[model samples]
Target: MGERLVADLIVERLQAWGVQRIFGYSGDGINTVLGALRRSGTPRFVQARHEENAAFMAVGHAKYTGEVGVVLSTQGPGAVHLLNGLYDAKLDSVPVVAIIGQQSRTVLGSAYMQEVDLLNLTRDVASSFRQQVNSPEQLPLVLDRAFKAALADRAPAVVIIPHDIQQAPAPELEQEHGVLTTAPVWSPPTLVPAPADLERAAALINDGGKVALLVGQGARGARGQVRELAEKIGAGITTSLMGKPYVDESHPLAAGVMGHLGTSASGFVLGECDTLVIIGSNDPWTEFYPPPGAARAVQIDIDAAAIGNRYPVEAAVTGDAAATLEALLPLLEPRPESAWRTSVEEAVQRWHRLAAERAATPARPVNPELAVRELSDRLPSNAQVAVDVGSIVYWYARQLRLPEGVPAHLSSTLASMGCSIPYGLAAKLADPARPVVALTGDGAMQMAGLSELITVSRLWPRWTDPRFVVLVLHNNELAEVTWEQREMEGDPRFDQSQALPDFSFARYAELLGLQGILVDDPAKIGAAWNAALDADRPVLIEVLADPDVPLLPPFPAGEEKGGTMMDALRKEGRDTQHARDLLETYLRQEEGLNRGL
Candidate 1:
């Protein structure tokens, strides 16, 4: 071990820290490090088709394993490509580390080929920690701090190693900073709200007859406690997009999803609540929460930084989600079930009936919602779903019937496309025993993830079971953005630029040594889904849906009962009668509602 190379030391340290895989493409600047990684041969490197996909894969790995996932790329363009995926981790507060290979210091400051300031390029997204190792002696301290900051801040970090420095002999390693690696299951120091803050929160819950629990991604570990708090207070539970799979939607108090992707039932509960309990989440979107001063609010979170940042806070109890709930549980009185809870329950039940009708009654171009619902029905109880942002989320956010405790991942904070596939791939890599599904639109698949299908081709033969399923809702348009352009701008011309060239995803899959299936007929969707789940390989099911089918959120954009198909069409300048005709046909087929047209 005497006089080891700096690159070799880094690989050894990462291995000691329990890193099993690295995702990236190797180039001249990074060759030395790759060689060192190969020499150690313990942590395997996953070669992705694109640097962006490599970044997304790292994020996926971090989220599923609850550890800092590592990604690497050579300098300049390779570094730039990591930005989008790195931003996802930063925005979502997921721990990830990106290592970039730099040109030799001998070429410093000449604007050399593929040589840009690594720290400067990555600073915005990797603000937690960004460092360049100038000397071989600087390697240990910089690497350790990068890992430390990534975990402690729950954000992405970056480290740059010049080509010349990486091959230099490592100095006597300094172990004085205690264990260099972060905890596998990192837990911040336990924080309890002051006695006065607790009393204030307790008073609000007791005084407000109708309480509503709004869960966020931050409130992940406290699902049971959140449920108890809701039930005890006779409140309904609603979740932000990231919190959608945290609580069982089947719970009587469940208001289903809230915020931009909110269900009508959840929206009603949020609007009607007298007091709101914000748990583990900053609740980033203003649209998701009640208007400021609309209701008294009690906020509980692990990071004090988020308290009162998004919404006005009457009681800010800073602590772990579950722990804070436990502390407050004794201080509050359980309110008996009120009309509020009954109303929420009634609304949810109505929604279920409506949803079932819609799923059964179908129309031409197929109801995307129905397709998703049917797919949801066939997926195993423990299936891990990675949902992309956009039209696909319209189905996944409202329709995908996720069982409680089933882990789900998404790029909610960044709200980016092309994340779902790599997210699923990362999840599958972490836990090969479970089935992982990536739900995306045709635009998203073509954007970033399509190339990574080749990555799957390279890795899938060794996989023991269903490595993953990429469910593409093939409408051949950026449906989510297209809807926004129409509704927000009142612009009906959703020109060619908004549309995608139709693709044969099944045929594309075949060329990659993977299973491919096309499901245009609704009758065969279930069978195709079953075959994919049963297959030992990764499968892509391209579901041909309609471009005209309006993809709407569960609730209205604002405070209205009009996320309905009619409303979407009306805004797009379709005549009232025509809108009604489309709606009636859809309702009749999906919901069996033929009462009027």
Candidate 2:
């Protein structure tokens, strides 16, 4: 009230950019900025359990809402804690702006308490744009540039402000010589390839007898165009994990996600296709793509550099996916329904049967596949989903059928664990009217999900519709990495490193004043989902999943790796018979698929 400080100006600028909320934890270095945010009361501040979780929430907000997410933190440890989430944004190509606090200017190179070199620390994660705010006059330019860079590059940007600068008086811009005032202004550009490039791409597509499309997150806006393109060319579509939400999995030609965590149907489509069209996806699994010269590829991406990064491309169309596809559709000659289309559809049906069989298979208590598959039917049409890393991702990818327009996001490129709860929190905060479902494994829940549940307990009552449901697959093991060691290293699961301590996830949820349902029976899985969705408050459904379920890759690749896995299991010495049997079951299923039985 006395005079506007630099912190006040910073908050005002954020509001001008239409930021409704800022996620962070309070710290001494950032106390002044926190005070300004409290005083203005325009941009609400959501306190997170940890700086890492707060950063994940920021990334989640950007992913779900298509807006620039903002996060704040104090010096040293708080800043270091933000690295994982910031890297998640960087690897997944999300827009996030991190505003970090530094020690007072007087501390200089004295290495004062909590005074760390944040600029150097964040060099790689925020390589798109990183700067230290030295003066009040430079604050506006830095803030505006950070937002612009984040939006433009679809990456995280950093702005480090010293404690002294945050407390300084706001500067007045009156035709100043050494000061620059920047407004937060940006607009999406309409990018389409030239007519010649479009013609070439279309000609290549028309020439191929068997065509396939590999879609990624960047093609999210062009779902209709993608479907139309596939229909016109009689093509099968397989999505990168990040692109799964954009395409309708219910489509007959939809082959499901492509990669190790992908479906057998996707493996079939990618393996058989003669022409590959990569759209807006720079998926890292190049080995899963049509082998070397087996297919002629055309890549479409907004970022030109990413076009040929993953696979060799014959036609590199540097343009926005929706705009490029819209233009190219006119040039494409529709192909009549052919035998190739029939084969693709047949593969898809086979995968459906295989998945259902796997999900229904009996386990000691509950099959993790069944736990996730049950949610596919009960998931509301208006729900938003957040998936965590680990074995749970495999079930979510294979068993869950997301209705069109229901966005499901995760740490795909980074493959970072401990992200689901924070991501769900961000999605819920954006539009509390829409219910959110978060799926996580016990390993991730132990790392960060449990702490964030307390945040949910404190905030859920304020939501308009309290239908935030958390699904914890309590397998009591790091199942994904356990299988990784067997398949990759041909080594048994080491109890010292792979086993997790026992914890009561559901009871803990109840202690926090939320509804908790513990299900060890497969029959109760559907009912648990129903109750959670219908609950008046946030609910956590903990399922006692079996660790013996194999995390096998999709066939041919999976079948080839079977011998190595069998060797590792045999080395487990004892009590691994169930796991070996499960592995044999999956191998037989793949063999049947190969024989067309």
Candidate 3:
């Protein structure tokens, strides 16, 4: 059979898979594919200034649209630029297909211009990587396989199209292959609980006078099942930072998140619980601190490695959260209605009341916490929220409550800064009809590709019209968690030097043809938020915050010293002191709040 050009064949396959937009950067090597796109005129191309931003935008699109987001780049540096974004997509489980235009097949190892080993570089970030195509005939099969791998693994996949092959042409497109249009089948790894594991876990639940249930990102599709398990087990439920969307906060058993910025109730319940059942949560850094001398522990997870990775588990059930919970339901003998459930519920309510009381204070500058609460309350039920990394993330994680069934996206694994703006744009692109809000810190937003706002404006004119809102927490500094490290070391330099100049972020937004509002007063935050959301175009609400405010203390395990600054601080004898002071202040405030003073 005669064959179509590789570029044409790829575009045809993408169209068949329902791809509507290709977010990418143009280059000489990929011009062949671009020409093919121009001629075939199927999937529309949305050009980005940088390949990394293009990949990020595609990730946003995929998350919101539930379609395979496509990003194109030239080989070598261009392909390398996409690595971070690709890794983000992979870790976050966003389905994306990246196509790189490689040097001609003739120069495979000749060090031709823009030639680099893309396949090797992309292997770790991509679920599957295909080398450059040498023949037009192989195009259809390769494209088909790429899509399947991307969707099946729930990750990003890369396909390399050689420049020479993309230019070669022979025949018209063939009939659509059945495999090309079908969704990949996903079967959760089958794991049945051991008879002993179930019995032991059930016994722990029955005997414990107080229990707590903690959920994580792995519980995405199993929220209802988790809630049912919590109710049946008579346990107070809390979530890891990444698991906030799993259960509605309105649930009586919900005790907010349990971590660094976790509520006072979380600490109380976590400390007091006789048993802790960790469900699909692998976060040991902050979320899984076992209480001192607790009754026992049960862990359920799909990944066997995570079963006992953190705390010592008396019972480890290696199975999917929802499926395992369903199975365990029948095995659990009903317990008598006891005071344990009521006690936890009362504690949670008390904490909620205290939080409400604290928020009622009308401070001069708007309290950041109150702003977060107001935004959480005002946004539409289905509004999509994309949060940047910083102290602001802590606030959102602890306070913001999304309506049930609404999806929220964040960079949980990498926890990279500057992800909010791109994520928001991507969310808007993914579902143009759904209102999208970006909660970003000023420092982080400055580091992001501001030019992408132009792309977003061009793509969705309404975003520039005033209805879109980007809430900037203008703390005027990096506000890194490491300040405590500096303080503990008795270094006076830690506090103010880290701050940034008070530039006009709102003005910058205005220059980009979006409405801009500067919020300095606590009482005016709600009005500003409402006005921004009411606008017909995109709006930037730059909120000025005190940079000196400390982040909440780390959990019992202490702050994670992962990066360079943290390592440096550790060497200077500054680490432990900073952690101690931060923890002390946090505990004091928490105690005061709990006392109803």
Candidate 4:
């Protein structure tokens, strides 16, 4: 501590940027930065069980808090382990900064241990900003730029600091020609489309009879504007998975999430609409959209490129969702409640009834739909939700009714398994007073959740409200993949790849000194949820769910996929009769709904 080192400078710069914590794991390569963090003792350091999970926690931090999440790791294998989570941030457009430690510069070409060309390895994921610090004088410049680029692009950025550079003496920038000083500073711009563009969009909306709005995560801040516009124009509102939390699903006109794992109401709205308004969303499921020329379209987005990316937009308003809607609202004339509006509401009501019926359907041990839907009413108003990828997401999207203002996030675009626990940890750490509930499937539990539970056990004692509840769908099947193979490839379930080894998730939580509740009886699902939500410590609720429940997409698309699933199941012979029966039951129900729609 004689004089501040470059590592100390790095810590000071992070504090200046308002970073309160760094998610990472320890290794010899990064010992210097670890020492600096220990000595300075400003930003807390969170150590995960592995480097991969550490990276996931950082991405989760960014997603939950809307801040530039910082993660540190030693180079080589540790850096390699970070790729998946870094890609999750890149795909979801979350801002994260990964600082990696490299081998000493003196051993540049000597093939030293734990030496990775991290700059090259991370180039794709951190294409927005990827830099390596070569000198102590370069640390500040690189660090500031990484944060700025991450904010500007809303993407992950990478900074690789060699061990020698990290331990080098901190340099002072002065009135020197070659030296530069930088501060951690950046802010979002107030962006709105031109008046003429807004007027054009308004005209299109006013002209259309059966209008539908497709909202995405970009419209998060414009919820009020979206509701007002929907009211003024008498339009139905549907959200992409990423936009689910932003729009109140409880709204009468709310059609729920749209796309493969979407609701029947959404399918009807998108299928039958004559006019579509794409608002701050470039949802990738183009097939679910209205057929080409089936609708007149208007698009609004901050990024000009995304305006026309999904659908054919006759009017493009390149601006922020809230601001653009404000300008466009005044030019619109309110449409009186009509048959189209009535139809939309009817569809939404029908979906609600259908969801409840589906949830109550009996299964082998428990119905996942029923298990997750139980949380709808039981969830606290101040709770935050994290859902892992798999069949569980379909249940979350279709059955769960999140309270207004409650935020639920998942690795949607990346569709990565094992993200829920990390995301839940980040959300809980951000606001310990609020309850956190994570919904994950058994496959994901084994992939990453098991190890992360240790992290949860270690941290729960420090939480003000120890109400972190994790609901695991313990079906002993890779249910999503099993269905995907049948639907996509028309292949029978290859038990080797589609089945999972069993593990006692609830008992494991008990071993870790946390509360554990196992529910196999469908009748006990609600009681289990109540106990876990009100528990004094972190709780893991393991539900013995049935894997036979179909992962069918919304109808029309579901029709073809259902046919493929039937063929595959038929090929499985009489041994798979139960699954075949379940599929047929769902298909019949969907066909009836389709006829009504």
Model 2 per-residue lDDT tens digits across residues 217-314 = 98989999999999888899999999999999999999999999999999999999999999999899888999989999999999988988988889
Q: What are the per-residue Cα lDDT tens digits for candidate 1 across 431-534?
A: 77888888888998899878888877887766667558888889887877766655555455355678788789989999888999998888888888888889
* lDDT (10s digit) by residue, model 4, range 1-597: 477899999999999999999999998889999999999997999999888888888988998889998999998999999999999999999999999999999997788887778888998999999999998999999999999999989999999999999889999888688788888889888886888898888888889999999999999889999999888877999999998888888888999999999998999999999999998787888989999999999999988877788888999999999988888888998985978899999899888877887898889999899999999999999999999999999999999888878889999998999999998998888889999999999999999999999999999999999999999999999999999999999998889897899899999999999999999899999899889987899999999999999999988788879889999998874488888888888877777765674
lDDT of 2 at 517: 99
Q: What TM-score does candidate 2 get on C-alpha atoms?
A: 0.99
For every model shown, the clashing-pair count is 6, 0, 14, 0
How far out, in Å, is residue 319 in model 3? 4.6
The C-alpha lDDT values of all candidates are: 0.79, 0.94, 0.73, 0.91
Using lDDT as the yardstick, the better of models 1 and 3 is 1
lDDT of 4 at 257: 93
By lDDT: ranked, best first = 2, 4, 1, 3
**Which runs of model 4 end up more than 4 angstroms from their true locations?**
none
Q: In model 1, which runs have C-alpha deviations exceeding 4 angstroms?
A: 1-3, 174-187, 554-580, 583-597
* Cα displacement (Å) at residue 221, model 1: 0.9
RMSD of each: 3.5, 0.8, 5.1, 1.1
> Which of candidates 3 and 4 reaches a greater lDDT?
4
